[model samples]
Target: MEIQKNLIQLGQSFKTKEEAITFCGEQLVSGGYVTPDYVPAMLERNSELSVYMGNFIAIPHGTDAAKKEVLKTGITIVQVPRGVNFGDEEAPKIATVLFGIAGVGSEHLDLIQKISIFCADVDNVVKLADATTADEIADLLNSVEV
Candidate 1:
């Protein structure tokens, strides 16, 4: 998956997970990755299962049913240094890095794996979260091994 520098947003703060997801979806939509309908699908998928990966990373993508909404394969990164709660207040799953994805065909699976492996290290996730500019995040994500 190619991480477009234009799609990356650094130092963002969201009040809610929904807001964060919405921003992610909008980024994808604006980038011509998916149709507007894909946004709601992303939210629904999140509601059904937590997209929050450990190590302060969250990968938000649409459901299988929304695959038709994909216009192209794209990835957008949103950095929230302050962190946003993806779980309930009691559980508290905070995500400092959000990866919004829209994939064509089966590319999403590989993309997810690549992202997972890259973010398995907390230091890598911190590099992304602490990114000062969009290019920094893009460079880091684009450097994903495999």
Candidate 2:
């Protein structure tokens, strides 16, 4: 799947996970990747379950049934420097970045694998979180070995 260049957002600082998640969905929606309903669906799932991936990243996606809300397979990433808490305040699963995926069917798995590879290395994850420009983040993500 081709990654849309406009979906990347770097140097973000969200106070809460909700805000971060909403921004991710908004980015995807603004990109015409998924419908507005897809945002709530993704948020609801996030509320019901933690979407945190290791290496300080969270991969958020809508429900499986919400695939119909997606216009095309796409991805939007937000690098949150301050990070966001995905668990209890005292023991939070803080994430340095959020990768919002608007995928159709099997493309979901592919996106996850690709993103996983991107974040597999601790240095790559740190680079992404600290990236000052969108182009830097996009270039790093685009270089994922998949």
Candidate 3:
């Protein structure tokens, strides 16, 4: 599946994972992609999966809600000033969080997987976190091959 470049940017500039998810949900709602009721559920899911991987990175996501609608499946990237715990017992300075939300039985799993792989690289994660604009982040993502 061809990942939408705009969607990738939507996931990379949130102030925090929570903000990212909320903002993304709002965007989806405004864009007629999802219903407003789905936001709380998504937040709950994010809270449940918050995990901090050392070096300022956290991958937070929801459960089945992610796969509820193809249009709802999107990744949100958040940059925090002080960072959050992410439920990690040690090394929890995660300043950047990536939230992956998928629709039910999403056919875009490949795209999601590709994003996961791209984010696994510490250098890339750092670059994404440091990116100054959506276009910059898009450029960074474009440089990565699926």
Candidate 4:
């Protein structure tokens, strides 16, 4: 999925994973991509399983049950230059970029796959994490080879 300029928030710093995820959910809700209920579902999904994808990134999305709450396909990217911890004391997982998604049907799967492949390269993730502008991040993602 190509990054939307308006959906991206650059230079963010969240205290907790929950707070960061909430911000992503709010972005989706405010963008008219999903219903308000979808926010709680995102939290629930994260609780059930961490959205932390490693390499300083996290992709938070609603549970399968919350699929019905989606109004349209959308994504929100939050760049945390300082990074946010997404793990416990036993293991520390600091995420510098958060990708919140609300997709219709199976569309999000393709997006997730693309993101996974793009992010698999630690250098690419660093570029995103260090990006200072939304347009820069968008261009990076849009220009990347799947």
Measured against the true structure, the TM-scores of the candidates, in listed sequence, are 0.96, 0.92, 0.64, 0.95
Q: For model 2, state the Cα shift of residue 52 in Å.
A: 0.8
lDDT of 1 at 122: 92
Candidate 4 has its poorest 10 consecutive residues by lDDT at: 137-146
lDDT per residue for candidate 3 within 19-136, as digits (tens), equals 6567656654554545676666668866675544445655444456544533545444444444444443563345564534444355345555666787777787777777767677
lDDT of 4 at 33: 93
Estimate, for each residue in 1-146, the C-alpha lDDT of model 4 and write its tens digit.
Answer: 55678999988888889999999999999999999999999999999999999888899999999999999988888999888999987999999989999889987787678888989999999999888888888888889732
- In candidate 3 the C-alpha lDDT for residue 43 amounts to 81
Residue lDDT tens for model 2, 1-146: 55566887867888877778888889989998899999898888787887888789999988887889999888888878888888777888989888999887789789989888878898988988888888787777766633
lDDT of each: 0.90, 0.84, 0.55, 0.89
What is candidate 1's lDDT per residue for 22-107, written digit by digit as tens?
Answer: 99999999999999999999999999998998889899999999999999999888999899999896899999999999889987
Evaluated at residue 103, the lDDT of candidate 3 is 48
Top TM-score model = 1
Inter-residue clash pairs, candidate 3:
11-76, 11-77, 66-102, 66-103, 67-102, 67-103, 67-104, 68-103, 68-104, 69-103
